[model samples]
Target: MREVGDSAASGAGAGDMSAEVMVAGGVPLRRNGDGSWSEPPYPAVCANGHELGPYRVTIGVSHCRCGILHRTAQCNQCGATYYLPRPTDRCESTALDGRHG
Candidate 1:
């Protein structure tokens, strides 16, 4: 329900962006027949021809025990991706023990 440009500092004073994620009919997006929720308005294209849209929040990075991190988006070409909930002040992510381009 929140615009991609909407933010906590937009002067609307609606609180942080994290507090405003909702689904269909304000019912909250749920799992589809394929067991995946309809894309949250983010842009995504999978190798398998899966196209998603408008993700509210992007998974910046995910920390791993191997001293690596992962990103939410994966390259359709190489079939590579990462996880989520990375630490603060860090945007660099690790995937499959290598760098992603």
Candidate 2:
């Protein structure tokens, strides 16, 4: 598997990241013979043609406002983001600081 970039600074920094981080093509994607996306989370390519890496978002955080649990793929090349749904058991949601309600 090809590692994108320095994940620490590629897409996540401080509180900017909201999606869970996964490995590249870690979403059980199989390349179809037609060269199309067999599984959505398979080939995470950005609109700019940049390959997206695995990233996770928050799920059941203490005070998460997103409501659902999922992760996001961020392009290590162009810095773009894509949202993908994931099971809550897969990961935990990121808690928001100073959250109320």
Candidate 3:
């Protein structure tokens, strides 16, 4: 796993100091205020343009319901599976969409 950047170190506000870490397959997961990880609000799409679903995050891995690991997701549309890439940071994400304190 790799971290693209740390919001806290960048002088962000206290409520927006979560670090963004890049997991396997380049999928970027944001650290919650409680220290947990979660996917972005927008769904991730596979290379074939198929939408991925049922994104689940555990201890150190994120995956689909199919038991894939390391931020990998499977497309129910075309049965395609692959690692996800880090998405561009957005304003809303910096604040964790208001989900965290």
Candidate 4:
């Protein structure tokens, strides 16, 4: 089976830290540039007490009609989907009109 988010950049374990991201595996870190990903990075915590993270490129975002955007990560440990507040300029995500946190 193919591992999720197993891209060429993700495999660069410890390449150019500048060009490569610790989350070169995560969605936000996939973008190639020279700037901060966020002022305060969003957390990827699941209720299961395990850190939710990117397993593949299956991450997404949901935007509430109230204008709260959430960044998402699927738990590799429990196969659960966790949503954190979406920081600006992270991913070109699909928007929704429901509220989720």
Best lDDT among the predictions, by candidate number:
4
What clash count goes with each model? 11, 14, 0, 3
- Candidate 3: global Cα-lDDT? 0.45
Off by over 4 Å in 3: 1-29, 39-43, 54-71, 84-101
Give TM per candidate.
0.24, 0.33, 0.33, 0.33
Candidate 2 residue lDDT tens string, 11-81: 33223243223334234232343433233433446767865554522222132244543455556666555
**Residue 14 lDDT in candidate 1:** 26
1 versus 4: better TM-score goes to: 4
lDDT winner between 2 and 4, please give it: 4
lDDT against the true structure, each candidate: 0.40, 0.41, 0.45, 0.46
CA lDDT of 18 in candidate 4?
Answer: 36
* Model with the higher TM-score, candidate 1 or 2: 2
Q: Given candidate 4, what's the lDDT at residue 84?
A: 56
Q: How large is the C-alpha RMSD of every model relative to the true structure? A: 11.9, 15.7, 14.2, 11.6
Which stretches of model 1 miss by more than 4 angstroms? 1-44, 56-60, 74-101
Candidate 3: pairs in clash = none
Please, what are the lDDT tens digits per residue for candidate 1 over residues 5-97?
333222221233433433332223323434344433223665465553344223444544445343366544554442332334544444555
Assess the local accuracy of residue 81 in candidate 2 as a C-alpha lDDT between 0 and 100: 51
> Tens digit of lDDT per residue, candidate 4, span 1-101?
12235443423222344343433223334323443332224455766777644563247665544344566666667766655543456434444533233
